[model samples]
Target: MNSPDSAAATATAFDKARTGLWVSLQKHLTTVYEAETAFAQAIAFAEAFPFAASSASPEQLDLYWQRRRALRDLFTDETNQLDTLNKAIRTKGYADAEKKQLYLLLLGYMDIAASIFERLHTEVPKPLPKDDELEETSARFERVRKFARLNVKGIFGLLATAAQ
Candidate 1:
């Protein structure tokens, strides 16, 4: 019963919605990638700090602590951003075909993130030497890595179902 012009307009609107979804997904993926990089840097710093033959000066210790804090903050911010993006997508609706495509793309990214996190968690070093500082750092890294893996899996499952 819709006129040709009206149908065309509807199609255009759907296209725009899909485009918006893609943009949002891309932004979230970028944030995730950045968070991953920050986490890797934090791990490297932590690993190097403990192995240095010379005693770490107070300044060096402070710098390592600062890096750890920064990485945590980055992860928090990225998580918040992902939540916002999910709300936006829900509000926008996903009944249209174009929107379904966007949902699939998001699912793909979520899968990738989950896989990366799992690999990192399994590969990361554990059981630090008797040093308390090294033990604490290793524990923190393990905790975050585990959290990331679990988070990614949950997100991926949700997105996959939503896309379907």
Candidate 2:
């Protein structure tokens, strides 16, 4: 566990780009979490109201493909950002607990985001979830998501407050 002072020191020691990247990572993480929540809600909505057609119309299917493509693009972009972050971490000489923050960002958020892209990309004609499943998914991810949000917020605050 990193102390607040260490966090402050770490943030202050980095150049503006490094600090800004850290904040961007936190914001991206929050977006990832919110995206997951929205996805679950969409599933729940779909479960309640089944699609009118047994199969999607060409336009509808095209829309799905477009969304999947967009998600893939976003995931690719995030991965590039993560590569930048990893290099920055290594360059900063952060060891021990300080490095753990990267796991929270790179794995907790980015990995999950990537998995979402994979799942959507691999969806067969209608890979629908069971009606009851989304509730469980929401419950399970919410706790971890909240924890991540809090820690990321704290870290960002510490970083932002640090003197340049």
Candidate 3:
């Protein structure tokens, strides 16, 4: 019963949705790369000197804290962007195919983020150990990972139903 123009419009919508998803995915990947770099820097710092040693300098402590703060902020910004992108996708009417594709892209990024968090948490450097600091970092990483995973999964599920 669908008219030709309606079918064409639907195809256009799908294209738009795919493009938007691609852009968002690229941004998310960039964020992931930044976070990975920061993690590597942290590990390097931890390995270069003993954080737990009594002789650890105040400057060294500050530098380490600064790197962690910067990385955390980057991830937070990325998460906020993803939230915004999701909202946009929901509000903008698009073909079912497009919506499903977008949802899948988001889900994939969430999975990647979760994987990165798990790896970081499990493979943390053993030297220069500060239990409290490590715990805090791990907690923050898990928090973001959980939020992204839950939201993406929910949206993907909704899109799946819509597509059907």
Candidate 4:
């Protein structure tokens, strides 16, 4: 159904894109973890100082906000790239519908990650959660990252199959 040359080219391009996405995602995750950690530390500081119990110290908030902004910017770049890639795939008619399904699955993973990052980066009028709650949020994020890793591997496998 598809030419070998076309498939090879698609595989190469997909590999390159996936690698970039992987690196960016890793950095994004690290940034998110750092932000959460900073917030948690702030919460701890607040608890120790009853006067600041209502909120974290200004320095801590600033650090968290900085990391959150970084995360938001990184995620925006990645999603933009993905949207472009999706459009390219459609234009090129890469492989078949089956291959497209793999891409869609990868998109789903991104959507879930977006939901997590959105909450972190949004300007909601809500106080940061307690340390214990923040740990749970971190756990959820880690789980999503792990699942995304698996999804990425699966997509690579699909590409391999298509290449052959």
Candidate 5:
């Protein structure tokens, strides 16, 4: 029932979609890491030198707040990009079942990444430091580890499916 041309067209579409998804994901990840590093530095700075009016300048404290705001803004921008990518994928028509499944899995993964960013935004110390900061940090690392494992498995699955 399937013509060679149609099959080729489908393959092209699938490849294009996959590339877009992965590129978007990579950008999101880079932003996440940058934000995380800035966050950790801010926290360390705060903990090391308590912001006493006598000890620290108003300008120094202002710089810290500025960095925090910038990180929050970065997350917001990333969330918007992810939402746009999600919409594009959802609107696209996937004719092949295997390709569709792969697309759907990727869409789900993007959603997870967005959720992680949302959590990161909320947890970003608007005020800084709670008793549970350490616990939260540990949990975050675990989540990243699990996500990394999923990424590896997903890539291998895609390769195997393509090989067939």
Candidate 6:
């Protein structure tokens, strides 16, 4: 028979994970917002001047190079934070089922971000993303953020019952 001590410990572990995940979501969401804004602004700036894009090769343009560097830097930072968050949960002694669920949720969030960034990085220089596409990507990221915030709590509560 499972002991109440284990249940209590599980609850405590979940409480800590939930709190840390909340913080991570907040920070990651802020970075996502900033990166989206910065990338759009960079594209707009390049478009406004017109002549800045005057090159036989889009890669030769200064603004193009600048955006590439920016995306690379942002992606590097995000990867590091993602690694840290994964490590935190693994060492926390959560049940395997809960751990897998959390991992999948985190990956979903990361995929939304990576999609936006990758689309911008690839399409921004020459073709420029369609307004509809940009809107769709923004909407997708919003959905991911909202879902992550709401679902993580329920997951924690659900796992708490398993403790019993």
Off by over 4 Å in 4: 1-54, 121-164
lDDT tens digits, residues 51-135, model 6? 3345435544555557645765666566566666666656767776676667665866677676767645354444443556445
**Candidate lDDT values, in order:** 0.52, 0.53, 0.61, 0.53, 0.56, 0.61
37 Cα displacement, candidate 5 (Å): 1.2
Clashing residue pairs, backbone N/CA/C < 3 A, model 2: none
Candidate 5 C-alpha error for residue 38, in Å: 2.0
Of candidate 2, the 10-residue stretch with the lowest lDDT total is: 44-53
| Comparing 2 and 5 on lDDT, the stronger one | 5
The TM-score of predicted model 3 comes to 0.61
Clash pairs (backbone) in predicted model 3:
none
Give the number of the best model, judged by TM-score: 3
Using lDDT as the yardstick, the better of models 3 and 5 is 3
Off by over 4 Å in 1: 45-64, 93-96, 113-164
Query: Which tens-of-lDDT digit does each residue in 9-91 have in candidate 4?
Result: 87887666556555665665666566545544434443332233236557766765565556545555545555554555446
Candidate 6: pairs in clash: none
Give one digit per residue, the lDDT tens place, for model 2 in 1-164. Answer: 98999878866655454456667867887766665454444333233333433455566655555554454445555555665665565466665345556546545655466566445434434444453433344343444444444445566666776754
Q: Per-prediction TM-score, please?
A: 0.48, 0.49, 0.61, 0.45, 0.55, 0.58
lDDT of 6 at 164: 78
Model 5 scores worst on lDDT over the 10 consecutive residues at 47-56
What is the C-alpha lDDT profile of model 5 across 33-63, one tens digit per residue?
7776675565444433334433445665565
lDDT of 1 by residue, 19-138 (tens): 776786677677667766655554553443234423445665455445545544544454455445444554664453444455455556556555444433232334322435434444
Ranking by lDDT: 3, 6, 5, 4, 2, 1
- Structure candidate 1, residue pairs in collision: none
